[model samples]
Target: MWRCPLGLLLLLLLTGHVALGAQKGRGRRELAPGLHLRGIRDAGGRYCQEQDLCCRGRADDCALPYLGTICYCDLFCNRTVSDCCPDFWDFCLGVPPPFPPIQGCMHGGRIYPVLGTYWDNCNRWWQAGNHSAFWGMTLDEGIRYRLGTIRPSSSVMNMHEIYTVLNPGEVLPTAFEASEKWPNLIHEPLDQGNCAGSWAFSTAAVASDRVSIHSLGHMTPILSPQNLLSCNTHHQQGCRGGRLDGAWWFLRRRGVVSDHCYPFSGRERDKAGPAPPCMMHSRATGRGKRQATARCPNGHVNNNNIYQVTPAYRLGSNDTEIMKELMENGPVQALMEVHEDFFLYKGGIYSHTPVNLGRPERYRRHGTHSVKITGWGEETRPDGRKLKYWTAANSWGPAWGERGHFRIVRGVNECDIESFVLGVWGRVGMEDMGHH
Candidate 1:
């Protein structure tokens, strides 16, 4: 009796769910055109029996009790559904006068004429919860939360022209990893949590690595990002986000103490409840806890141990030039644009891919992010095409991408990674502290 559009009616007939749609007139509550009501239960009663719902081998949220699962087909159970659900093809695939269910025709609540990709356990679980909508976040929210935080004046975009020397046939090594050369110098990846403090973290981390490498393992200090996040508020906002150049400027003037002295909570003043006054005289000094006071960099005349970064410069646009900078210095800070698909990246070199969200304009939503460029390598494809990638260290923790690091398409500046690269020199005079 319900008049569905011609397309829906045809789809229902083709899928053999026409009988299900026809049950709407018989006192059956019609959720959607083809969706029918099997039964209903009391408010507190179980929605769907344990054995009734789809398990799909792994005990994920599919088994959870949902109001829809109790009465509707398991194919339409949770708020989101697709062919990935268990027994989807067995019972719900072309229901009456069953026809051979098309394999790979549907996935994660989406229908594809051809099988470009299929759903798996990881994608199913990730898609169910971790998206812009599920987290109550929109592209605007992400842009405001991440990219909008940094002040416009702090952008070092035009610094690229400083190092435009062409590396003509420099004959470089096959692959290079900064950590391999500077063992124990590059610190492990740190997590920034929900805050947008990647700017501060990447700056602080780059400074730490450069200092250790520059001093030839003499001044191997894990500089404190908390110092930059909590104390450096001149032209930047903590947590809410700030520019990396401002952080580097803060480092150049008001050196950061060791993490042992002032640990990093990763949150800035906004999210970290309240900001504590910069500690002047702390027991933990640069030279262990024994020293009463260590020399603050640039003669800050402050009590806390201070470190300074030399004036930051830009890196070349080409991979060869960037590699040369990495070999000479240490890790450099890079700001890149992040797309929606980037969140689901598990491993391998990442490239921007279109997400089929029933909308063509969804790709416009992007957020700016920062990372440390540590190394580079090349991988040959089966078709003889070469995929060169830049090794980037992210602040999202090691469990994220390739152990807290990800490789992006190199040379082409995928996601504008090669667009803005900045490097700084560590302050000298920390070689042999007490051994000399």
Candidate 2:
């Protein structure tokens, strides 16, 4: 046997498998002692695809094939094993397991636990084939512990329950509506060079959405594009990104002035000229404690794509049915494509995949065409595993484009982008576009 830490070993024995220590430094990965895996498969559908081996097949090899239902006992097939049902976020939000197995997990956002606990010991299915891993806490246990509740499909929505706790009469629609302090709505693409205020950008967008919806009963004129190009660069501690919530706070207090008044009178070369270092005056800078980069905000559902973040709060409950009812519906101020990541398939920059339709469908014609909704789904998995995912439509391109559509995890992986909503990032108090 190999040497293990202190309490970890005990927890492993009591549970079932040995939990591999995530290494920070560089060195060879040593397998845990007595870690017996069962039916593990590799990218070739025979054995485990050693990291050394897969690296060679990088560009060519997508990933391993499906390792059908594994009846656990060790780590995920070729991997090691664990005892306790590891934290859901730990695995889902963080790193994932090996190839083939992970491929399925990625598709459905089913972040399985390390060597499962006793009942449905996640460990038992360590190397099993094709079956969704049934690891970690059971449905009943979670409710008892007050951690989460089971939705219609068996998948657990911990945050949803917490969010709904205070509101007794809260309906599904209530939870998705715009919040207070919206100002910067950005359905269009604004060059970052034109602005550096990511906080201002998103805040304006939310404000625009709130104003339009509240006044006109639907989303009004599309907001400007130039927004949130610097908050993440200067004040925040990350790549030039922004958080919608933080933007909201700034809009409420500091209040963003119009670019017309501030005029980005920069040279052609210097598009977004750097202003004095960002001075976060509002106690509620961008998102939270202003670090360096743009992070996500609270109540957000996904971020992997754009369609998933489509402006649903603006539409009434029967909006879809009504739209279906009336074939005469025409273009509005904007169109939302709610994919896993909140991206607008604008031309020039993000046009990796142009509209496949030979005819340009007039997305750029009137003031109405702006957003589009792609992926959207519930919070459960097919195997009845407790999962939290983002449902969005994807246009991965004609290559892997499934009927010009795609869906992915909402919170974990790249999908966690719920913070891009109108109230969350756009502006409030603008003209409304009548919907209902």
Candidate 3:
């Protein structure tokens, strides 16, 4: 081989090394004049940085929440326009989020989103107008309105007491419905309007069912819940709400009339003022706004028509025992805890979904509500899972879920429905004693 000058050979080697260094430098352009490039992102094909606007002039780089300097090429992000890029690129280039499809159900002129963030869902419902908008309430607010009225707190001791009285392992019939046992006795579900009076409605409704059942269908009276809502102010707070125990006491002492006499005006307000002050019979002098003092405040002419219930008592929390109580005494009232997801319940045996928006552990329940447990049954879901559920009558209205009724998961104390069950006997008067 021809030997060249050593100095020249060394110079050649140095040149090669310098060229290689230049090539490496070119691969990573300085984000700023002196800053180094962050890196290459192959996911959506882009460059990102924490301190430099590397996404400028690029289509793919504008796909993320504007984190000041970082360029995200992700499909989407939650819209926080203040934190995002300018118009059009403000919400991940209008790309849909990688989330579950938002499901919704409409009732009583309100459309409720069944999934997604609770706040978003409620916001959507609030905008839909109707019951939710009528009260200017969000989903939580609506649920709170209904739940706030339940005054009975969950008591383990009470549940244990019921357990002792009832056999836990007792096998209940596979299926049973109170309406079937006593036809025409179970009245159609009543609408409580926007008022948080389900406690009273359920109490009156259950008592009415009991009256019919106990009297062997000889008497099927549609007791007035309006009476419980307006009057019965001792332990119960009219439209503000009341406890099942308080309602039972009122029924036992003061009895209500037919809904025909004293209808529900809880929703009927004068330009959104409190419902016409408990249209009561004026015992004072001249004829007052009420129908007549001739009848009880409940509006029943004959005192015999006025029915009362015995003191309310607790029942076993187990499903079997609950069924037995229904079979024997008609329907029982159930005070249940409501979660954020319950408002979207449309049909099927309702069980709280796994999606709990990181709610604090201390906030046990969003609210409480009471409903009448009319029956129980087992259902097979489309996925082939067996679902044991209780049929509950709601006061929302016939327009809501399954004609003003809902089926809830049973035996598991779902939504704490079985936590505090109440039962009572309708005291039979001479009139009732002979009718049935």
Candidate 4:
């Protein structure tokens, strides 16, 4: 038998296995250069580095925030990409990832190889190494697809507009108040000092309230995360950054909020205990502080904001049932959805310094600038002093998480909320909701 060059033979084998795998599925390029070539990805969505030797290129999950690398061209990569990109949802929205019909590597540094890559069944140009742009956008596209596709019911009101137009002396409902029923009580732990997760506090309070309303009757209000974080709402001028207490007031005025439209800043994270008074010169003073939390419930971004709210019992209904349930439980925790592109700021509150969004000069964190209802409020370090704040949680995981799990401010801060809080609004669920 003729002896072939060992290196050459290995390359062919790696290439062959890559091909076989893709063919097995629809078409997935192997993630990278290989040894076994069948390496598995881990919790961080990465495979072991010991298995392959890939050609150098602009890696999606590479340097800095990238943490590690993936062989963009490994077997079945095309298949994986197909399964993820231009998904059913993306197809509906005008913005879909390029796949199958347009196969090819578009590496950051202009390196599109002819031999190492091939566009598979979907007609994509995939290579032996990974093409993160394809992978990353796939998830985003999927989400966008969902947003673009989910047919909105005529009854549902646009949350963004509602948050902006809310006025003081308004009333809505809690599940219990709406149904004119009593609510159950379920106390949870507090997460003291943890910053980024404050949303959880607000969310939990809301959810618990909902469950209580659904389970029992009208209940008392819980603490507010926005108040605790020194970030609350002022007017709908967008990200004016006020105290958390205002969140409840904002919600009372408006039934919901559109977290997708507005962008926020952590410019004053360290200024503790309610953000400075609104910059909206000559603003009218609002009423009592009962505490609160608001929900964005869309997009994959983690951002914080201040808000205001007025106190009132309410019961809410509609697509916002989830938010409504939580809101009725009293002030709860909430979290802006976490995204891969952006990180949450915990080192301080939203004052003095602007939360770093990676780019120094730009100073603006990009992405949907949207929001989500990720996790709930968890109280950590509640031992009176040491670790005496509430923690929040999100679907995004630890890295994007600031504080501990997550956190939100409480009490006085709930007065000037920016977004709308969902719940039974002074017998709202029982109310006509104007039309629906």
- Models 1 onward score TM values of 0.64, 0.28, 0.63, 0.25
Q: Rank the candidates by TM-score, best first.
A: 1, 3, 2, 4
Candidate 4 worst ten-residue window by lDDT: 39-48
Candidate 2 TM-score over all chains jointly: 0.28
For model 4, residues 136-208, the per-residue Cα lDDT tens digits are: 2332332332111112223332333222222366443312222222323433333322133233234334543
RMSD of each: 12.5, 20.0, 18.3, 20.1
Shift of residue 407 alpha carbon in model 1, Å: 0.9
Winner by TM-score: 1
| Clash pairs detected, candidate 1 | 255-307
Q: CA lDDT of each candidate?
A: 0.57, 0.25, 0.56, 0.27
Q: Residue 296 error for model 2, in Å?
A: 30
lDDT of 1 by residue, 264-341 (tens): 654432343565455433243353222324444325334344566788887777777788888777898888887655
Better of 3 and 4 by lDDT: 3
For model 4, what is the alpha-carbon lDDT of residue 213? 41
- Worst lDDT 10-window in candidate 1: 36-45
Alpha-carbon runs more than 4 Å astray in model 4: 1-139, 142-338, 341-436
Better of 2 and 3 by TM-score: 3
* Candidate 3 wrongly placed segments (more than 4 Å): 1-136, 153-171, 268-293, 296-304, 359-365, 381-385, 433-436
TM-score between model 1 and native: 0.64
